[model samples]
Target: MKKIYFFLTLVFTGIQVQAQKDFQGMAVYESKTQAPKFEGMRANRDITPEMQKNMEERMKQMLEKTFILNFDKSSSIYKEEEKLDAPGQQGGMRIMMNSFMGGGGTFYKDVKAKTYTVDKEFMGKEFLVVDSLPKLNWKLEQETKQIGGYTCYKATAVKEASKTDFRNLRPKNNDDKKPEDKKEDPKKTSGETKTNFQDNFELPKEIVITAWYSPEIPINQGPENYWGLPGLILEVNDGRTTILCSKIVLNAKDKATIKAPTKGKVISQKDYDETVIKKMEEFREMNRGRDGGPVMIRR
Candidate 1:
């Protein structure tokens, strides 16, 4: 009860302070995902421990990333910070991660308008995905914590897992279930959702997101596709991954001007996802060897 009262007082003071200023803030975030483990492959003697270690290291380097969020009162732009790949080594893993995870380009959201426009680069083509901001039914919890010197409160929501993102993604291995799910799989002994070739595939129906937000910031903005909180979400844990704000510049001298992308074919998010799936299927066919394999399917 005391925490709630203090939080509300901060929010009121924040609104007053914000109203007097041209309020723009920049926040730096560290994002990381739990790379799916291949239990079946680990059990195989042919796959060495060294090979597994190397693979894990590669994924860690790719999945662990930095992002910047620039925001005002009711609008924000979230994007990955620029980083150089090793010389002559095109970031294949990073590129695939971007395309497969529906990441890349700027993610701009307008809270007042209830709209969001995002850019997606996939398979040598760019797409401008224009869609209404997803409405999340956020349930505010009384629990509070501190993040980067700011008091933060906990809130949770159950979102319909997006098919466009990596979380709900699973390769359709010529069947509704994964290779390990079928009895015909040579390596299958148990019904665990694990495959040797497909280390990253899980079909979760919903995404439960727990966010820690600070009301002192006083903005309905969050990292990535999450928003509509009473404050700026400083940390988000969506089961398989977590995004945490490391630093914040409330009002910097050189503010980033938020702008929507002008390039690429304008399409709704649904159509863009369908396009991605269709292109992926075609790509799979072209590269299909005698030892045929898996492709993505729509939810």
Candidate 2:
């Protein structure tokens, strides 16, 4: 009897090891952002009822989005699912509006290497941004909850807001001329020269991020750049944005393709940010005297 029991124990251990080794799967997440209220316009009596309704609808469309994470033990690929335009919104106006409100690109993370890569498109040009993974000082708590049928533990961290988070306000410019060349142009005036509005516009310095992770999955991955946890993150709330996992497939028979995106100009994250800020300044310069255009004011 003892010998039989020992043999059975060994067999069960082997099975458990195999199960842990084959823990590759995919997770689907739905994210929602709280719509901003144009309080200034409302207080000044500049917002009409029809304009308010349109703003609400547009904000809803921009804030609600879906993403998929295809991950294994040490690496993952997170990308936004492509969404079709609304019916009857195939006109040039729709395209122009969408150009201002863009989504993030494919993000790849390698936990072992401590690196991340993002494929982003600004204006019409593509760029591949490579950078180190964000080092979040997460405070793991004893608090727990259930998400998507998995028991999750709570963790919180504080991080600086990323530049990509403000993509809507920083629309890209397609001009090929350099900044110095643009200044020397005879048609350009001092009043129309580029101004760094971002300097005056203060974004939140630190965002409080909350995440719920499931140890059952045993993978250090999550939607977007949130990672470095002992388990799979099932839900994340970063004040303005919330990402919740709707479904998780473990050891799926049909494995997902987890590959890095390879299309765009290769650049570091710092360089890309500088390029974007400069372009946004140029865009402001180009539209300095424009009247009747959309005005975006953040309070």
Candidate 3:
């Protein structure tokens, strides 16, 4: 009886230690965005081959990024790894280009609590967008692949156009007019103007998202707004961009410090998106009548 009791106690203690070890870890993900060619924009511009190459490289540098996901069993904090610019390199057009691309943000997800928070910056202002985790109707597939030595299973879902994606669809302003600056015209009333903008600016209805998850790492966590899977997502491709796990360190000597972002204007995700659109419209209005202004590049 004493020998059996001792064995059971050892097994239970080992299970407890393993469970604790499974939840605390960090993952490194590399994101690559395959932006469409700017052939239409270059058609009218006097862009030399060298200049085109340089521009493309700069754009790639901006889009291709690395992120770290520090996670426990039920919560995770994902943040971009900052890249230092080359010495004396100016961010002239690249900065403007990034504003249109609209992505870099820190995301926090709590699966247990069904909550999420995003630390986003727009036009030099920080916004803490808090909201519930988006529920995805993922269709599990029989397909399997290995990512960073982990056997990952395939899952897919459809989601609405993200705020970054919506920014790309903003219609060009005919003329920058402040709401207070313009007098009411019979032919072009406020309602008509709004209708015209809505006609021109159509948001994408659905975005196909493909994710590969590993059951071995049994954590329902992923980068950005993706979650609710039965396992840890190792790779995700949402049409325009792909984020893949390059490295995962489990049970390290030092645990990653995962915390929700506290500083920024508190707002819901919907409100934050509206704020972005409003600011973008204001920028268009301010840049009205300016020659050689920022051109929208379709990707």
**What are the lDDT scores of the predictions, listed in order?**
0.78, 0.74, 0.75
Pick out the ten consecutive residues of candidate 2 with the lowest summed lDDT: 191-200
For model 2, residues 74-177, the per-residue Cα lDDT tens digits are 88999878778777544444433333433467899999899998888777788898999988999999999899789999999988766545522322232655
**TM-score per candidate:** 0.79, 0.75, 0.78
User: Order the candidates by lDDT, highest first — what do you get?
Assistant: 1, 3, 2
Quote model 2's TM-score.
0.75
Per-residue alpha-carbon lDDT of model 1 for 100-135, expressed as tens digits? 765688999989898889888888888889999999
Where is model 2 more than 4 Å wrong at Cα?
Answer: 1-21, 39-48, 90-102, 167-201, 293-299
- What clash count does candidate 2 reach? 0
Over 1-299, each residue of candidate 3 has an lDDT whose tens digit, in order, gives: 99999999999999998877565888999988875533323332577778777777776777788899999987899987877777655765545555466555678899989999877667778778899998999999999988878899999998887664533354434366687866664434434332222323444567789999999998899887788888999999987689999999887878777778887899997888788778877876776545544333332
Off by over 4 Å in 1: 1-21, 39-52, 87-89, 168-200, 283-289, 292-299
lDDT for 108 in candidate 1 is: 91
User: How many angstroms is residue 171 displaced in model 3 relative to the true structure, after the best TM-score fit?
Assistant: 11
Q: In each prediction, how many residue pairs overlap at the backbone (N, C-alpha, C within less than 3 A)?
A: 0, 0, 0
How far residue 208's Cα lies from its native spot in candidate 3, in Å, is 0.5
Best model per lDDT = 1
lDDT-superior candidate, 2 or 3: 3
